[model samples]
Target: MEHVRPLPTYLAQRYHGWKATTFAENRAWYKRLADEGQRPRAMVISCCDSRVNVTSIFGADQGEFFIHRNIANLVPPYEPDGNQHGTSAAVEFAVTSLKVAHLIILGHSSCGGVAGCYDMCSGHAPDLEEKSSFVGRWMDLLRPGFERLPAEADETTRRRALEHEAVNVSLENLMTFPFVRSAVENGSLSLHGLWTDIGEGQLYSLGISGEGFAAV
Candidate 1:
């Protein structure tokens, strides 16, 4: 308890504002959600970027999405080594427990995690390449994307390409889970890949057929 700190004045003020505005207007809805338990139709896996606003982008009300955020919106290949796997646990809960109708991998432009992976793979960020770096270890999941990128592309293009590839990689990795694969094959669940341009407010959906990402 000694390490705990009080909320900053700005955040406290914003909480009060939200409580008075959004909470007050949705009081009944909130109470119903609390009483009935959540039955979210979709599970969204996205990056921890502050710029990515899943609720705002989808116009989703509270309790509509089971969302999980990590460094790069990545889903590692299924590993049953009996170790701690946060993403895998979330996926299992969403797929098997919640039985969500859709699972979405939301990637974005200018993602720091993807950029870090690019830099690390390009031999530009030595710190991230260190063995003890947790971030380095996590970003290793994106190495497949880095490998898939064009070798001679310019920095800007390569980074953006890798961002797209990150979504593709996550989608591929999602199928590695038997539960997820079974659900998809039986028409119980569908998978989607989305990429966002934060600055331009544009969104693209990756084709289910592996053709190309199309603006949506």
Candidate 2:
């Protein structure tokens, strides 16, 4: 609490603006959501990138989707060793508690996390390679994806491939959770991988074959 601070001036002004306009206009809807709780049909796991706007991209209203954002949108393999796992906890709550039918791993272009992983794996980022770097350990989840890339690939191709693979790796890790696997096996849950080009605003979905991404 000592470290907490008041909202910045710009954010306070924006909040007042939204409160007077959007919130006031949708007062009844907001009340309904507060009273009835949320029943979102989908869960979106996206990156902690300011450029990627998940709700705006899907035209989703509040409570329409349960979303979780983390660096690179990566999901670590199910390791129920009793350690803290924020992403895993979100996935469990979404699937088991919320009963979301669809789980989406959303990746994007110019992902700093993916780029860091690439640099770390390629021995270009010594800082990230240090054992004490949380980012280094987290990005290790994408190392397999990095290894999957061709040695001859140029920078652009490698970065894009790793971004797509971040989605693939998350989808695979999602299945490793017992609850997630059960939900999928029972047909109660589904998984999807997606990537977007920030510059072009074009979306691409992972192919069913898991080999490539196609424009959506």
Candidate 3:
């Protein structure tokens, strides 16, 4: 790692411009949304990793994508817990309130959370009893992905296998919600699993056939 702190000259300059322009843009868009009561077209479940900015990736302006980001981009099975979950709340708002038509679960390569999934499957996960970080708990949703992989596979291959399979699990979990399932059955909503290769900017979407994923 570089021992020096990188100068934020470019970032500062960019933010200064954005602060002015973004305020102007939001003011107009807010009025439009209020007047027309516009609804978002899609809701995205994305990784909370700083590197993967979903809105920016989609070139979205303000309210284009209803977004929920959490570690590993996980979707827990529908449980009306007495407590509020950030992701769950966003899903509820997007589906029931905002009436988004599409829900996208985006998984990316080189994900630390996914690496944690690989670690969990390999039986080398960090102790959760210590309250290490949100990632520790959030990543637990992916534990099942590990169980789905072959036990005899080598570590490197196993992780790659788990990464792909984890996307499949995330797609399955999306339907566990009553509203999400109902909407799909009623033809009001569509769900998709997408794999993003940040290193190459390639997006692969799981096909309807359920056999192999195809490039988007």
lDDT winner, 1 or 3: 1
Q: TM-score winner between 1 and 2, please give it.
A: 2
Indicate the residue-level lDDT of 115 in model 1: 91
Residues 1-216 of candidate 3 have per-residue lDDT tens digits of 678887689998988898788766688777887888757899998887787878767788776888888777788878887877777778878989988999998888788878976775456775642367666767778778878787788877777666676678778887888988899999999998887888888888888857757788
Residue range 1-216, candidate 1, lDDT tens digits: 999999999999999999999999999999999999999999999999999989999999999999999999999999999999999999999999999999999999999999999999989999999999999999999998899888788889989999999999999999999999999999999999999999999999999778868999
* Tens-digit lDDT string for candidate 2 (50-98): 9999999999999999999999999999898999999999998999899
Span of 10 residues, lowest total lDDT, candidate 2: 205-214
TM for candidate 2 is 0.98
Clashes of each: 0, 0, 0
The window of 10 residues in a row where model 3 has the poorest summed lDDT is 121-130
lDDT of each model, Cα atoms only? 0.95, 0.95, 0.80
Predicted structure 3, TM vs. truth: 0.83
